[model samples]
Target: MATIKDVARAAGVSTATVSRVLNDHPSVTAESRERVLAAVERLAYHPNAAARTLRSADVTTLGLVIGDVLNPFFTELARAVEDEARAHGYYVITGNADEDPRRQDEYLDILLEQRVAGLLLCPTDRVSPLVEEVVRRGRPIVLIDRSIDGLDLPVVRSDNATATRELVDHLVALGHRRIAIISGPTSLVTGRERLAAFRAALAAHGLEVADRDVRIGDFQTASGVAAMGELMERPDPPTAVFAADNLMALGALRWVRDRGLRPGSDIGLASFDDLPWFEFVDPPITAVRQQTEEMGRAAVRELIALLNGRPARSRTLPCQLVIRGSCGERQGAQ
Candidate 1:
């Protein structure tokens, strides 16, 4: 086993520098840090995380607890957080909590036991006790992509309600009288807020959100397929459909094709969260684009500021509805 001295000597830097990098101190330069890491790898020196934590009494790590790892949105957010933390000389420990507050709480406790310097979370359930516990512990923290009401921590989120409302308004302007919506779990803040906005947008146009036209799923492809099928069953089927996430949108598109209907041509569609694959599909999907990358970078900037003694606050970035063929209303209809 290679020791810290060997790593330091091979990298041509002092042991102190190696220790600083290992400790994830923000002052370590990236080039020097990479050299040290390369040396450690070449020497096959694996630092015992437990031993290091016990000896220094500091974890020198950050934690990111997300709701769904399978969702590209969460995956992208986690990637941004991890990259930023690494840039700041901190290793990030990430895991999905399956959107259960209980699972989230458990993961929080585990990370706390590990004594990570900070955490970024897309929380599940009420999450007050977990938030209160972290605050009580005086750990540096940032909330991402969602907010917990009655909590004092800083947060980064896209303007969910306004964005979805704009999508609804666009469809209405294009002359879609009956627009159906498929959403993720309403228990989560994003889903709940988006649903609220969807309903409000319908009501604003004097359109009733028929119960049969609305469906709730887990933001998975299967759910989207099922929801679209249900909507198609309505006595007066919707003229347009809005899927709340990309996976569901893909599923809806699949069902439309299965029925020999062309998307954007035969049955109009609009959705939230644009996927890269959308551009390849027949007529590109019209979507309400959330500033996902911006949201990620902003969360990192906010988290870093919080770590640097900045006062905490929350921010919601704007989303835009892009006009595309999928959302164009039929001509010469009724």
Candidate 2:
């Protein structure tokens, strides 16, 4: 609770002299500097971070707002971002939008008010006016995992098309002609691109996804469970199911278990994201793993570049397909 005045009184120097010593001004005598340092240590006096940040145009704090908290993918991403920011001598404040656009905007506003040096976010909506305004004002922002349509913001995202194709082709080669997909919302770029990739891959293999075979999920577990239920209740359920994200994939697995059906045997299941636990599950899952940690670190690099008045470019990290028993023995890429 010690203030600048307390430090000044303890140091037997003027507040201006303490300020000069704290700022490392060359004019301060060695004797004054030692006194200020001793006082600071004795009182455990901490400078006002907000005031210090405002004193200079440089920002020592960064902000991260993720689209979902329940998804372990985003949680890992947040951790990676925080670690990277800390390494760069910056502190990070994270917010979970929980897939709500309104909440996403609110978090954005809060960060802006805090005067964060830069922002890294996985946007929940197609377009946010607050984000657009921030961009127009030339504030540094890096988009991660997802992006809006027209915004020209720097981004770090997975190349889902190639990976989705690999997964679908692997399933096709396994003799799964009728493939069902649990897709995320079409409103988001990741959702649209992934679904498009699935369809495109199937078409290339002389197959098609029927309207009934495609179930729309909100990128949440409950929606995944519901979608799986609907697909399973069909007169002719698919032989293979692909969930676009890990949580949905887990939801699909739960539905399969509830029916006493085993994946890789009764029905094939594949997913877009992979976790350590995925390999140890009842049937090790087949998945497309994105460079999640790399994506977070890259986003920080891009934002820092922008903060330094350098041009920030978009990044597309590749995803690798990891095949296992859950998808019924992935046949080599067709």
Minimal lDDT window, size 10, model 1: 325-334
lDDT of 2 by residue, 182-247 (tens): 999998999999999999999999898899999889888998899999999878899999999999
Instruction: Evaluate all candidate structures by whole-model CA lDDT and list the values in order.
Output: 0.82, 0.92
Per-residue C-alpha lDDT of model 1 across residues 1-334, encoded as one tens digit per residue: 7888999999999989999998688999999999999998899988867778887754558888987787888888888777777787878888788766778888898888888877888887655597787888778888887777777778898898988998888889888888888987787677889889999989999988888878997777898899889988657788899998888898899889899888775778877887676767778788887887777767777777777788766788998877677876533321
The C-alpha stretches of model 1 lying farther than 4 A from their native spots are 1-44, 57-59, 329-334
| Candidate that scores best on lDDT | 2
Model 1 TM-score (2 dp):
0.82
Query: Per-candidate TM vs. native?
Result: 0.82, 0.96
Q: What is candidate 2's TM-score against the reference?
A: 0.96
